[model samples]
Target: MTTIVVGVLGALGLVSFFHLGLFDLSSLLRAASNLRQFILETFPPQFEILPALMHAIWETIQISFAGTLLGLFLSLPLAFLAARNLFGRWVAGAVRLIVGGIRTVPSILFGVIFVIAFGLGPTAGTWGVALYTVGYLAKLYYEAFEAVDVEVIEAVKSTGCNRLQLFRFVIVPETANTMISQLLFMFEYNIRASTMMGFVGAGGIGYYMVGYVQMLQYQHLLTTLILTFLVVMTIDYLSLRIRSVITVAKN
Candidate 1:
């Protein structure tokens, strides 16, 4: 118990030393004042830009959806090859290593690379999101595939089913719902990621956000933020509802 307390105190001390800033009464008051001024500047949002904001947000949705679909298509085969339960250890290890390497790079870096290659547009953003999605979904899929009941797999194999047939008839069916759930989660994540892709000129509402910051258009920026918040919240709620329904159906 004493050792545990000492470790906890040391961890807290390190966190405070590295991650947190020293806070003083004056610093807090100054921060509060700055926040109040910023809020005042942000009010009376520019409703006139609603049409443009809507269009930009729609583009973001398109990028995310396209990327997620393309990623899902690409990830399926990679995941199948990476499943240790389906394939031998050597094959699974090699495939998992490739997937892990892909995942090691940040999605934003992928966006920057695509932007450079494609020369700045939604095209770059879409491809970047797709590649990132492939890495993520492949990992999720293989894990889900591996988690399918061993007894079921063995039972199917005992019936003289080939490996491919086993995967098709047993593994796929058992993991289909989980696959859908992960896909939905990735789509939701990509929406937010797509917004950042615009920073590198990959295209999305983030481009407008950058412009607003540069031009000091606080009112318009606030309006854009509000719309984005609402859209994200709506997507989150819908995803939760769908997942819950899927769970109920599975049960």
Candidate 2:
């Protein structure tokens, strides 16, 4: 017991030392100083830009919504195939490989590539975010499927139900809540990613933020920050409400 305790303490001490060295306090202080200066300069926001900001906010919402909707729909079929217990080994392996390939590419890179391919607009941003979302949702969804009760599945199979019937009557209902939860989480992430995609000329509030910062339009930057805060808060609240409703229904 003494040897085990000493080993655990030694491991923890190494971790602490690593954190102290890797996360150097001096470097953090320098970054914080720059951030403070930026915030100070952005005070007294430009309220006049509210109309334009509102328009940009709407575009961001549209991008997130479109991407999330497409990802959610596409994931439904793919999730079943990817679930190891539900499909043949080859089929499941292929689906997982595709998902892994998608995940390996960053969303920002996707945005850049689509921007070049589709030209400068939300089309590029929407598609980029959607592709990323597909991989993200599929991974979580397959896990949810794997977690469902095996007894329920076997019972449905014994009832002479085919694969499609089993999926519809047993799997879908059992995993519906988990799937919806994953989708909502994806939308939350997409909202932030969609905003950042605008920096690559993909059409959202991020485009305006980048422009304002480049021109030293600090007041406008502050306004953009305010709009982002409001939008994020609203989405978070709605997500909570939806999650609660789903939980209640499931219970």
Candidate 3:
């Protein structure tokens, strides 16, 4: 009876999908045609724009690294306050509210506003990315703090360790690995977001891509794409290596 019911539900889902035109043949054909055109147009990336591309790529990396580091520094105290085990309930609630409010605003909107306020430069992009990253990293770090072993905390308390000492000796060590991992993840995301901020004149590889595409320079756009890919991949690889080393050390 259960198997029959499951099969019926699966069949109904398939029927609904088809009814919604999820598998429309014409849509597939159109997508294929557009993809073919894009492929034909964007080939053999322009090597001539290497100097400009290199500059933009460097700016993108700087934006990402600076923003991520700023966020990490700002988030440390906020994460401690937000952690249930670290702060009183009221303090934790207040910290959570602030973090939540910051996160509710989209990062792109932050970038746009910063561009206007700071007058369109990498500084604006740095702050925008940093603000977004703080919300995310603070939340992750708080959760890590919360997940620390209660017994270890109690042991430290029994030794007459004050709140600050307990935090230093027990909580920080317990969550250090997780915090590093979260920072790396946030850095990876910041690299991607920095590119988008360039659209608002925040000075990154994305700005160059927009300029090139608008000028109908498809070859340059392709080269920018390749360069961005290589840079992001290298950072991701390094982050993974560091994370693995940390994990092994902890074990």
Candidate 4:
């Protein structure tokens, strides 16, 4: 216990030394004053920019939907091929390696690459979100596919079903509800990600956010931020309701 306490104190000390920097009261007070001034400038938010904000919100939804659909389409085949029950060890390992590598890459990097490839706009953002989602969702879905009960798979096989038939009729059926539910969750996550894609010229509300910051339009910036928060909350609430209904139906 004494050794553990010392170790914990050492860890905290290192974190304070490196991460927190010096505890300067003057710096803290200055930051707080700046924050107060910023808030005062942001009061009531610029309601006049509602149309532009709405349009950006719509575009964000579009990017998320398109990307998630693309990921789902691409992930399904790769997931089955990577399933140990369906493929040889070498094939599965190679596929998993590729997927893992993709997941290791940051999403913003994907946006940057796509912007370079396609030039600035929604196209770049859509592709970026799609590629990242493929990397992320494939791993989750492959695991779900692999977890399908062996007895159920064998039962289907006894009917003389081929591998493709087995997946279509048995595995997919068993996992369809889960797949749809997860896709909605992915859409919610991608909405937040899409907002920042515009920073790389990939497109969305982020450009306006940049503009507001550059112009010192604190009111407009606060409005944009609030809109984003509301949209995310709405998505979360809707996703929860939909998933609950799906779960009940599946049961």
Best by lDDT: 1
Off by over 4 Å in 4: 2-15, 18-22
User: Lowest-lDDT window of 10 residues in candidate 4?
Assistant: 17-26
Residue 126 lDDT in model 4? 94
User: Clashing residue pairs in candidate 1, if any?
Assistant: none
lDDT of 3 by residue, 1-251 (tens): 99999999999999998998878999889989998887788898988888868888888889999999998988988988998887899999999999999889887787898998998889999998989888898899889999999999988899987878877898888888888888998998889999998988987898988998799788888999989999999999999999999889888
Candidate 1 error regions (>4 Å): 1-33
RMSD of each: 2.5, 3.7, 2.9, 1.8
Q: Sort every candidate by TM-score, greatest first.
A: 4, 1, 3, 2
| Cα lDDT tens digits for candidate 2, 1-251 | 99999999999998997887756888889989998988888888879889978989899999999988987888778888998878988999999999989999988888899999999999999998888898889899888888889999898899898888888888888888977877887898899989988999887888998999899999898899898989988998898899889989989
For model 3 the local lDDT of residue 15 reads 99
Query: Stretches of candidate 2 above 4 Å error?
Result: 1-37
Clash count, predicted structure 3: 0
RMSD of 2: 3.7
Q: On a 0 to 100 scale, what is the lDDT of residue 32 in model 1?
A: 91
